[model samples]
Target chain A: MSEESDETLLKRLAAGEERAARFLLARYLPRVLALAQRMLGSRSEAEDVAQEVFLRIWKQAARWQPGGARFSTWVHRVTSNLCIDRLRVRKSAPLEDAALIADPAPGAESRVAEAEQSARVAAALQSLPERQRLALILVHYQELGNRETAEIMDCTVEAVEALLTRARKGLKDLLLKDAAFDAPVKAVSGERQ
Target chain B: MSAAGLDEQRLSELLAAYGADAARWPEEEAGALAGHPDLKSKIAKERALDEMLNAFKVEAPDAALSARILAARPGREMRHGTGVWRALMSALWPEGPVWVPMGTCAAALLFGLYIGASGALTAMSSDPQTETALLSLAMADSVLEENWDE
Candidate 1:
């Protein structure tokens, strides 16, 4: 049923129900894809990572234990680990790695500026160390709690907070040095909410 | 208010690390910082950072990506059948150490071997035809000996 929880859906999935797989895919695909994209900075690579994560989910569903972690958390853990592994392998060929660039050719002039700004943000994110970037993505974008992010990162909650602080500072430094947010960043400290 | 309350330094650090949104901040810190007059301007600065960070939106993957992931699955056909025997087995020992059935089979084999050996021994001692054949052979040998003596 549509109202069933992820654990119930997993039980059906383990029993080979096709609809359960569809349900899981529909619910988690966007989140996983977004995480993968943010982690890897490549659309094609993120897609591969998402596919691998789902494949692992299918294999592990039958043996999934409910008490340890929620299904969504487990899925994010898988996605994060796979993305990190891919990033590790890409370290040797760092020059080959490039973030996906968006083209806003057909849009209005303001839209083009927005697209360029988005690209700069993506580049700044990609420039961060893998762990720092991941910490930012988990807390800021994924909106997971500190404890949950710690569990995924295999660290304590304090460590996660420290990582986030450093990430925020690092992103600020990167954006300031570049000309991307120069106009508004100068006024950020004085700006009122 | 100073001992358990959020001081300016800690509140500033929390704002820098977590965001302008008090809800996203750690519960203990959020509670301590709530309605604290010193934190208003600090939170306003943090809000600018949060807005900048939130501006980077990730586009959803194409439909073809979903199709690819779906196609890579091992599929429903590869799963075990849901027959009564299978269901019962799954219920009993869904995943296992696998030694239970093996131990039972070994014990049954040993019992069968023991029964077979004891039955063979009993049959060898109890058969009338075999006993009669032995007695007849002994009598014929003694009769031959008496004829030789004569």
Candidate 2:
């Protein structure tokens, strides 16, 4: 079957199509898992957040309307809010443990180098104020524009831009200071150049 | 590349755009690279940094991880209907269903009518004196006994 749009699948599910439910779950589940994993860091917690996000999707899908907001955008808002709430419970789950950011998948030899970079990014992110970190993440990885990012962050566009300015500088300082960042991207580049 | 410093605002703008998609470049901003020798070098440096950040995509959690996470879904982790309202009235309410105060109001009205009727009936069934008093009170046309003639 051609992949159903989120709106269509939601409408079908509302109309009592069980198959639509499964299809909906299968499609967005992976990415939501990744997002949760990024926020929670543990495979276990990410899994938990993933399930919660979908089950919410299951309950709410029927009420979803097209053109209200993009499904991807909605998911980011929902999942990101949940993550932030989870962070605030002071759950003793350190953002530090789950703190590492991920880059594109790299070859085996460069994996160690990438891990180090992830670690630095995580630390830098931790050093930022919560709002700033949230603002940065929404824009950086979530790919939300300033307007949407501001909405999610509950701030103005000017505030988001200001936060982004500081956040970029922070990331710059973090990366430049990391010893691992001095290493080359490809396996061969470090030794050759 | 020259030793000129990057203007902080413009440089941050480029980085923000680059973070979303490394290939994206704002026209006039990147176009400024040609005219300003200083900006030309900073542009190259910024592009390099953007590329470096893009190099590490976190491995998407494996399929098994997805399954595991999906299974472990948080929020109401307990078996369904553990909440106060859910525990008290889960079977009562369903999604999108509108509940009127219908049932409660019916029970209440029934109770009120029963009390009023029972009280009236008790007055009817009472001893003769009470019945006479009620009868006199309810009687709109009854004539009073002639005490003035005496």
Candidate 3:
């Protein structure tokens, strides 16, 4: 049930209660998928990572000790580590091979503008260094505390803060540049109209 | 530090790291930064960036992906109360109660003991000279050609 804690659900899962696995997947799959998508910038790869993460959960559920990190934190840690490993392998591949953000279905003008903005933001995020990007994702997007983010990154809180500081500054600069680039294109389009 | 005590530099650092939302800041420090006079300009700048970042929305995983993930879960055999030992037991004797195999083992042990005891008693009841000859023959390194013929 939604009222049950994650640890309890894990215990139930270990007991072979199918509902517990479903509950956990519903609660965490979205977040895990999103984190991987942001980290890898590809939906298919993110899905692969999500499947792997859940498989590990199923394998570890029986052995999971409740006294250490919270279940949610451990899930994030697993997902983050898996993404990092894939990114390392991807480093050797051509940058252009990374999938572009899929465009949202067409709708109102405002929706279109929002999607464009979202794409640009995603691109800017992808441009950041791995650690900085992870810090931002864990803190800003994932809504984890600096301390928890530090644990996931295997670094101190101070280091997380440092990474966040630089991440924000760098993101701001990238968005500003993107805006500047968009200005000329928009101006030309406006003139044609 | 108190709200009034929070300096501009520290506030700026917190804003940059945690964004314009005071709620996202460290619990101990959030109260100090909230409603502070110096936060007006800096908060506005960070809020703009936050708004921009918020534009990047990630949709929930589709049903297909969720199904795929759920399908990959460890099988029922691996669950508690049905581990490797249980699996092995099931493989060795797939049907009937556990007591069946156990009873079979017990029966075999008793049968072997009965045979040994009966054989020993029969040999003891034999003529004394013949019993001695049998004992000597059993201890010999090799049976002679005459014994084999017998």
Against the true structure, whose TM-score is highest?
Answer: 3
Full ranking by DockQ = 3, 1, 2
Provide the TM-score for each candidate, comma-separated.
Answer: 0.70, 0.57, 0.72
| Better candidate number, 1 or 2, judged by TM-score | 1
Candidate 3, residue B23: how far the Cα is off, in Å: 1.4
Candidate 1 lDDT over residue span B1-150, tens digit each: 442576778887887788788777776666666667777766665676677767677777678887777667674323434567545544554332234655888999999999999988886887797666666676765754566689
lDDT of 3 by residue, A57-120 (tens): 9999999998898889999999999999998898898764332653345478768878777777
Error of 2 at A175 (Å): 1.0
Question: What C-alpha lDDT does candidate 2 achieve relative to the native structure?
Answer: 0.58
DockQ of 1: 0.20
Native-referenced DockQ of model 2: 0.07
10 residues in a row with least lDDT, candidate 1 chain A: A184-193
In angstroms, the error of model 2 at B51 is 3.2
Q: By DockQ, who's the top model here?
A: 3
**Fraction of native contacts, model 1:** 0.50
Residue-level lDDT tens digits of model 2 in A1-193? 4387888888876765545655766777766765655554445666667767777786777688788877877777788778777767745744444343333334588577766666555555555555666666666665566777767667787778777656655556556544333323321111100
Residue pairs with colliding backbones in model 1 are none
Model 1, C-alpha of B18: deviation from truth (Å):
0.8
Local accuracy of candidate 3 as per-residue lDDT tens digits, B1-150:
565577778888999899988777877687766667756766776787898988888878889987777757767444323667766654665332355677999999999999999998998789987876787778873545467788
Query: Candidates 1 and 2: which is better by lDDT?
Result: 1
lDDT value, residue B16 of candidate 1? 72
**How many residue-pair clashes does candidate 1 contain?**
0
What docking grade does candidate 3 earn?
Answer: acceptable
